[model samples]
Target: MEILRGTVAANAKPTKPSFVSYVTPEEIKSESPRPYTPKTVKCPHLLPGEVMFCSANTVVKETQDDLSQRGVFGTLLCTNFRVSFVSDEEPTEDTTQLFKNKLYGQNDIPLSCVDHIYGGYEDKRKLITTGSLVKNKCPSKLIFHCKDLRVFTFVLTYSEEKDAKMIFQGIVHHCLEPKSLKNLFAFSYCENTACPEKQRKQRTMMFDCAEDWDLDMKRSRGVCRLVTENNNFELSPDLPQFFIVPTHVTEADMCQFHGKGLPMWCWSHHSGCALFKTSTLPLLPEDTIAQAYMEKMLTAVAHNYLFSVKTEDLSDTLPTVQDIQLAYSKFKHFFLIDNTTDFWMSDMKWFSSLDSCGWLDIIRQCLQKALEVVECLETENTNVLITEESGSDLCCVISSLVQLMLDPFYRTLPGFQSLVQKEWVAGGHNFLDRCNQLHLKDKENTSPVFLLFLECVWQLLHQHAPAFQFSETYLTVLSDSIHVPVFSTFLFNTHHHRATVLRAESPHSQRDPLNCPTVWDWSVQFDCRAQDLFLNPLYTEKPKHVKSVQRSRPTHQRQLSLPTACKTPPKKGFFKDEADSLKKMLRVKRISRWMLSPETPHPSSATREFYETWQRKPLDHHGLILPCLDGPSVRVWLQRYLRWIQEVQIFGGGAVTVLGKVSELQGEVRELQRRLERHGGSSFSSSNQQQQRAIRARTGTSTGPQTGGSRSSVRMSSSFPFTTLKHNWSYKPAIPTSVLQSLMASGNLADKEDDADPESIV
Candidate 1:
């Protein structure tokens, strides 16, 4: 080893635990010529091509064990890849620099292993101290959370303060680097070398999604204990066009197994073809209209696409042709029962077990399945249509999720609110029955389907924090308002219902707080549960005002940097103002239409009033419109939505195409390697390094699965041709057929036929 040790004053014997070291205050002062000037350490053990960032005099502290012991004084080195520290123990010449001194023991940590870094003084902490109490310089320290769930703390004093800021910023910058498939799969060092087995397992799990799934085996085994613990509900039989929602698909799929309203889209290939979600016919035999409507809907789906799925289940108790009215009746009763239990029991002692609730489980299952359908449509470029007994409950959930996932615009606050309105509210997800069950009956056959949907959306908001405008608190309050009877959720089944209720009431009544409650009323609830539900852990506060840091910039540049209309705060209670504006716009449009055609008979007063009253307000803020939230929330939502639009509509296609190219390149590289192994060296042998580098550049593929070794590191090409990709600034961008069909291939088994007659069950 090439060792470069710094001068040390003491010759104390090394301790049993090699990492431990002790330095007295007098010794530390003697080592530093100036009290404020920290001794910098240059690491001699830097890996090949590793660049040193900065170094400082600090103390190494172990966080996990020996909590009461003081930190060991040392010289810390920060590099592009890792942080290393050298403690003072061995004696050397006083004239020699710290970097030349002999060290007792070294502690090194790789940057890739770090999960989070705290600078010790966050904005929230600074706000707590009054101006008089606040110090000119706060104590500097760094806290690191590692991927292995280990914590590291380093304390800095005197001259080390500046180094703390630099090191903290450097670590954060490294963490914020654009993550790729390779970085996600990269192996980390346990001590000094990589952990291979752990990396292999994680990478395998990631690739498992592409592998063929055995639904029957999982069903027979009852593989997931969580699913078996809940209920004896059997998995839906694998129909010709649709598969059962599997219990063992992923660990996250635990809460969503064997629940009702679970028809799923079936696709032989991931082509951007119209999705066919095959489901059981309705359970009720009273009415045949739903069945007829289903057939007509299926026909329309088929007519729109060249190839569509047809469901054929061999063994199942569900009816083939269901009656809509009776099916809806059962749905309504079930929904009501579930909602009542959730509303009451959520505040009760049994709230912990709510995840296992049969109704909640069904909602979770529907949401999970719906997300799967959406992934197929959006990421995989497949079009999907759902089929269910009444084509309402689960159908509504799946379709809503599909729309939200596929459209970047829907991910915005107003778009999300409008999505709920269009899907659950207007699309008829049995809100009336659920509300009636919650309001009228205390027990039996109630469901929390709407609340479940809210939770599902919350999950998305949690995962993609930037994509949502409203907080979890907003959703929780809206749900609680259903029980309170004042909010629109209780009195109105849909937007139309709410509009009707509003129009019927006098303007004076609408203005009063008690008489006319909007969704905003939920925010005023002071209950512990209400407060808890309102808090969103993932909401990132954006800077309200941008600072002009550069005064010397050109006039035009400064003008451009000024906050745009989107950034400007709207008037408070903007929803009310917007609503009034919409009403006026509708009236003007009506008047213009009347003036254009003089020969048309004059419309009735009631007809004119109804048109004016019932018209759906135009969606603004980039086609997103949140109901109760103000401009700030909507603005935050809009920012996220616009970014999402750019990602999905503009950059997303290129990523997909790149992914396809990478997949092809990997296959080619493997084939060539196989050929090289079988035969003697050829012309390809000379270009092997180039080929391997290209593969690594494109995909983060491992060199050998058995050893879990990588051939090359991930290389992110900054010049990736994003500008060459076609751009669409619209909220809804058109998808090309070729792009959609690029990755389509048949991997699933062919559809099977059933012995049971199609219409016999109903």
Candidate 2:
């Protein structure tokens, strides 16, 4: 290596090579520069008139699955319409999603859907109600429990203290404590120009006007006459302006109790019997005057042409509204799980816990009551008069259920909507109070009566899937729609209340609330493709030629007639011995005639004939359908309750799979029909036959197992795609005896060993 020396001495000063500078040193050193302006946060898309009140950066935890979760950094926004979370990391579109909702995004929860809010601080979580939030500081974590059985968690640990507090208070005030009905997002949405006109693929009878009610009366072939006595709501606020009562019931009968205890016609059976619902009479002295009025009102209802009325006191037979509230409160807790640990912990004893909740038991009781009313109408040929504290609650439930089972028309999608309109909306159920739409915190008034009705309907749909034109998905979505305030269908307590709200002008704006949309217009939420999921492909329509037969009335009243008594045995041989022999002879005679038919056909021959005719009918969808009330038959609606639980979801299972298979088969059938038409009844060519054979082979062939003696055996394995061989099946062991024993001993499964391996022992 060679050493080199610099041209100048090391001690000499160096000169700087200068270039032009854009800013001077004085300008750069200025203490007061342009006022700092923070970049604006991009909010998620809002509804037409939805206004964002506050927002904060939050780490959203994936609570869908408990075992593993990744936090998504997003801005949590509180809008008038909903609580939305916007994340840059989330994909804009999911190709795998089969059902897409236009009204709500995956992270969007409607303000009305917010059933309960919880705050977490220092590892402890407490309910964040309006009253509690007033004095409490903002929490580091926030959780939302929704009416649709959805749970969301947001972490505010990384957010600014002020931002977190602002967002927390905003959500609490807007969601849990709305001041009036006008404040609901629905009114705002109606005012916006973006809100579209009511669009419906199918015609749904709203029963909002007299024409709809008249059409229903004509369709049911009802004998009752419609009255406009309450046209201006001068008679009763709870009743619709236009309603049909028994023909003999006069305006004076309706005036009593303000339409209470007035039997209103629900539907007419083909047998000339009808269903009626009335509210209970006011408490009065058990004197002659009260009794006289009650007798006169009931007499008018019973005297209706061709109706022998049987009064059913629903309050005495069915579970009370308070009981339903308590049961549902306990039942919903099992589903509102925050983490995998809590989910698994609850899953272990889900059945027993569900039973203890009493919800399913209530469902069973409601079904049994409906069946009793059905029996009276179908077999006894007597009209039913259902009375309750408020005819709107259980009365609507049983009436709707009766129509579903008795009238095939109600099983159809349009008819189902019409039934809800007729019995619930037109009947004036207090949906606003019962659903807690205003977030009033009135525990006594808030109950899941409508939810209970839906659950009952689910049972019927599950047991008789093909009987209904609508799918379980329809019911599930309809249940969620109740919490969405955009629907005027369930927003008000009475018809008059709805009318007043709709016609009333806003003081703050010139918008008309009358334009508020109804839930029946499904296009407001889902497009045609998405709406197709609501129709069941398996439903077979009733044959037009088939009609319910009207049987003639019996000449004499039927009574329990005992077998003709045999002649008293004559005193024979010596006293006691002769008596024993005579008794034995009498017993023999009764046993011999037991197998023989009655000398005269029983007076219930009409009932038996009707039942036999129903059984012989090719279509079971239109005729009477009795629900199986056995314990095993009353099942949890898994589609509605567990749809969000990722672990419980089957990868390639559920109704979607069945629907796909059905569609494929239908396509094949159509293709074959077209080919046959093209061939003009000629046989297929050899090549065509070969192609068909190949198609069949790919689809798999089904063969019936051969019978060997009394039993017909099923093959253990098949060529079907879903069929699995016995050896290929995997066995999952039950919970270890020690864990169960620990649970029994300690009354808590959490006390068991955490490290215990399930497969190792049990």
Candidate 3:
């Protein structure tokens, strides 16, 4: 594709009209541009593929390693439009239902209908902790609610550490002309004699053609192409030409976009921005963390100027810290609030003194420069929602107090560690302590903010003031005022346990691809979240990802105490008057003094009522609430985990012991019977005589020997014989004993019936 000097390849022949189509280089060289010191280029308006003069797009490398492309995609926050609707406050069931119904249009918005989204910030004058303004600020939202409304969103995202911000707000305002359908060099017929394939696709895009700017030239930005355009390029001509348009626009000229011959045209939007800020600290007295606080303050303060949808690069014109502080010094006394110039202005007066009182007078003379930046907003009917910021809201108020206390430093000749800068040693009074002295003021009847201010001031004095016994007392007073977080979220919450970066090969390394652990210091953040708010210290074994521990929690544990009496609002929202009865039931019943008196007292109706009331929810109860070390409470609970494990061990051990004992008892019984059988009628003394008699009688007859004392003794002595004889009628033990002779002498039968041969012999 070939690029012409200024006009598209619409001419049939080098017609006379070619002279009238575009401004020539002679005309460009003759004119000068507006609002410029540097960074301004000659505005070019050439059609794609027609090369003429000024090698603007010729690829070139610069002084720095970064290739500075002449054309990079950028956002322009220049649009201004309005739309109105009701804003829903908190997301409610009914509100959600309504939102769903309204999300899609009941009918299409015709090309004729025009819609918009624009907002502005107000001079909140929120005194910040820092003396500096926030950096890389973006606009906050104020949504619009309507019966049939839908909004397309654009976001610019990047990291402060990386010094980058991707912006996408400019495309909203750019208009695409709907009339011109053809003549765009889409796939082209470049009859340029310089080309082999004379008719080819031209690189001059529709967006680049109208805007006269190209952004693909930036290395970080990579490649991009126009997504929405009509396909209409003729591929014939007996002549030659080129196509490749420049991509950039001057303030005076707007883009003339390609169209589809309809009432409207479509343009795709995309963007991002990268900035380079030295990784070095710039403050003379303060540290980096303190500097970050100032940046936040600036963001909160300069909310309005940043609301423009067009994302413009203001880094070139942005003032340095010193210049900004000077602006504050100049503008401080001009605006009045309450009866005083206020601490912010007073600090401004001290930190950066105006060269002359006249210069100061200009500030005093001016009405309100802060408001000038903000007054563009028109609130929509949409509901506003509030969520807690990631960091402490309490810190914001504290920072303002510190700034107020440091006002005197602004005026001192040396100025915020100038002595340290000169001598390389800290000598001036500490800024942290100097700022906290404001707490000495009487705090009675102070507003919430005023009370917080007093607390913040007191704390600073305690931290940096001369070591004194009174400081602890001041701390006690401060503790009564604010509930500060225990740990710093940035230190512990974002980074790894240790401060060193992890390498992949080290076993302790946290650089596993799965976790992508950070190398930041996590101690401050961990302790703050753990020991301060929640007692379980946040322990991270692997920097890549910290696994959360789950302690068994009671299902009905009461989180807070309930109110003593009912004071429900008529139409309270969900959070305003939630159920408190459930909170009371979780508390354990306690034995009161009345129940433990010296004498047993008779039951009273009131006592019964008290006991019945114990049935109420824990939070609903009125007495003996647990106090936390900080604001969040530590719940005391009894765990049965260890006891359950012990019980299982004991039961299992006892069962095995009992089974063994039973087996041993059975074996012992068998051994005793065997011994008795082996003994028979021998190995016995006089006591054995009874055993012998019993054996002789039992062997003779089953029921024959009804024993007297001697026979019973004999039968009792024979363990095995007794057991066997009870169940069966056995003949004899192995031989008859001499005790049988004694029984016969006593005139006992002695089983004569079985001794037939003996009787014959007798």
Which one wins on TM-score? 2
C-alpha RMSD of candidate 3: 45.8
**Candidate 3 clash total?**
63
How well does candidate 1 match the true structure in TM-score terms?
0.28
**TM-score of each candidate structure, all chains considered together:** 0.28, 0.76, 0.13
Task: Write the residue-wise lDDT of candidate 2 on 227-321 in tens digits.
Answer: 88788999988889899987777777778668877788898865456888888876477666656776666665654433245677778767899
Error of 3 at 356 (Å): 9.5
Report the Cα lDDT for residue 409, model 2.
78
Q: Sort by TM-score, best first: what order?
A: 2, 1, 3
Model 1 C-alpha lDDT per residue in residues 1-762, reported as the tens digit of each score: 123232231345555775544754534445536646444464545543356777665556533223234456666666655566666643212221111112111255555444345544533212111221224244355666442223466666543446655655554444434332112111111122221221322111111111212331221221211222222213321111112222213322322322233333222221223344444455456656555444444443432222232332211212212222233233322112111222222222232333223333343344445534433333223234555554445555556654554344455444465456445543434554553422222313234445545655655564455445455435543543444322343444434344444454424534521133333323233322223223232232232232243235432211111111122234435635565453333211112133234674343342333223322444222211112111122111111112212222333333324543654665676687678867854444433343343333223333555325542212211112111222222332122334223312323212312222222212
Top model by lDDT, which number? 2
Choose 1 or 3, whichever is better by lDDT: 1
lDDT of 1 at 392: 42
C-alpha lDDT (0 to 100) for residue 488 of candidate 2: 85
Collision pairs in model 2? 66-340
Model 3 C-alpha lDDT per residue in residues 399-444, reported as the tens digit of each score: 2221222122211112211211111111011111111211212323
User: What's the lDDT for all of these models?
Assistant: 0.37, 0.70, 0.21
